[model samples]
Target: MATIASQIILHPVVSQGLKFGGTTLGRDKTYRALQYFSRFFAWYLINKGDKIEAARWSALKAHLGTARKLMRLGKPMEHLQAALRAAFSSSPALETITTIARQLGYFGYLSYDAIVWASTIKLINVTKETAARVQKRAFQFWVAGIAFSLIHGALKSLRLAKESKALKASKTWGEKDLAEEASRETRVAQITAARNSNNAQLALDIFDVWIPASGAGLVNLSEGTLGIAGLISSLLGAKAQWQSVNGKK
Candidate 1:
């Protein structure tokens, strides 16, 4: 205890987010918040042995700047709390498009906004995984579809299953799935059924949340891509109608 007190009282100045590395725990609220925020990111952006992003990270920067002004004048930074609140409104990295934003959002945080930022990245990165899974599943379905197209409509259910994976997982033709021809007969059948269906795209639950994803720019979603696209269209249509009738947006 004596050693800790001596360090804070006699040691060199510590930066805002620095850990003293000794046994003394800093009991400041701001310090705690910074500590918690730092936990989410395992790595941070640095340039030439110094962190590059600070104020320009996210809208959080705006909040922190305001707080600093309050601290400087000896006036109660009552709005510091508010700034903290606002800074947490989005992921620092994905939303801000700055180095600080990216650094802050490197790891998941307890803050909802921070999580929102990190989760979006997770979703995007996991998108490839989902796509790969779906492609494999699609291959299986396509083969089944071809095998059973001449037989019972049992494949309709299988096709539906593959489409479900695709829509929900946002699965697509990832590299591994595309390495060789989808040798699965069921997958071919599934694709064929989709092409044959009057409303093949009906099976997908498309998230209205649009992002500026990189690829062939904005391919038009085709109804024939998945079987019974029209069915999903109808269900969504009905849901919209219900929402309208119930006054629920």
Candidate 2:
């Protein structure tokens, strides 16, 4: 039977719902909620042993601006996929990596909101007050989003590399040693799972206690509340999976 994590990753209703609800709330809230949920969703997919899907999903989420630009430029989205595949090849050449990185750089430069704001200023007349505050906010949003994407990608890559190295090292052990190592790893995993369960319970408890005090101060309380609830739900779901793995009730 498929695991709950697998079901969630494959269906993605929870993530999609959060995105839709967040967008309805406000642009700022939408991206904030999305940035958080993407991390959670990526974790869920990885837990389900769908690391490739997780990576692709992470890439897509990080490159929405690139997607938008592809639409504007009449380029197919598959082009980016091909570029990424080539860039990530086991024996990728320096030129291939450079090309992909350059493309990403160009996309970031052209589609960034700061550049868009400047273009808008040149093409359309607006009050000075509107230009100063509103456009500046737009520029900030784009820069922050790009920075977040870079950091997220870098961290995920590092984690994957470490895991790969560990797996490769394990392969060098003899059969008996490998079996013993696997058993040891399994026990450690169980302890880790139990710890995760405790952490999740603590998080849910704190969220429940804090919601009443914090909810009143939030702008767009209903939407914000939904976003928070969604985040808590995902945490609880992961906790449940960990508990199940560890044979905990």
Candidate 3:
């Protein structure tokens, strides 16, 4: 029994999960996954005519959302700092502009969202209409941020494609360039990895945009659809964070 318990405690997956859960972002991602799952389950329950169960799930989703909002209360300043750093980055003009814009959009969104959260908890007093307007504005900024992220991802993909083409074309050269073959192969691998990462991020943003768009009234996605989308994106984000935590390539 002791041996079995030690083995279980020392399992790699368990160790990795503990490391992952140690970070604020990881915890947030876990909560986000649960929140979206609750949303989807609630919708499923509703469709099955189980109003009592659906209400419980719906309440869980709402509470998770509120908790996430509280957790992100300090994020606006972080985004602002990121925007400032992006403004002075040596990246290409379009890339730099889009990066700054995206960061600023997130900064604005989180700032307004903090206010909405405060109003919700009565930490700050505001009329219902005012709160709704503030929440809508926050979603609008979120939509803008996701839009810019998509654009940035597209541009990055194009750039990587061009680099990949050039690298492949070099492979056909004669023995004169044979000495650099290994270097070229390494660069090609890096480019491929970058393209994959960029595509994954693009997909995540694409799925996530609908939630904010719906909140802002720019789109009318069903709650079930939004829930599934959010769940997918949250998993994607969690995977990325897991890789980071595990130092995986």
Off by over 4 Å in 1: 1-227
Ranking according to lDDT, highest score first: 3, 2, 1
lDDT at residue 121 of model 1 (Cα atoms): 40
On TM-score, the leading prediction is 3
Error of 1 at 228 (Å): 1.0
Clashes of each: 34, 0, 0
Name the weakest run of 10 consecutive residues (lDDT summed) in model 3. Answer: 170-179
- Residue pairs of candidate 3 with colliding backbone atoms: none
lDDT of 2 by residue, 1-249 (tens): 579778887675555454444432233234433544665576668778999988875765455433333334422234356558757766325435544553454344334444344444365566776655554454343333334334434444444455545655665457868877787577556645544444554454444332322322322334335435545644564445433444456
lDDT of 3 by residue, 1-249 (tens): 999999999999999999999999999999999999999999999999999999999999999999999999999999999989988888788888888889989998999999998997899999999999999999999999999999989988999999999999878557877768878999999999999999999999999999999999999988899999999999999999999999997
Worst 10 residues of 2 by lDDT: 210-219
In Å, residue 138's CA in model 2 sits off its true spot by 2.0
lDDT string for model 1 (118-201, tens) is 333453344656545443443333233222222222334455566656544643465686533344445556665554441322
Model 3 spans with C-alpha error above 4 angstroms: 172-179
RMSD of each: 26.8, 20.1, 1.5
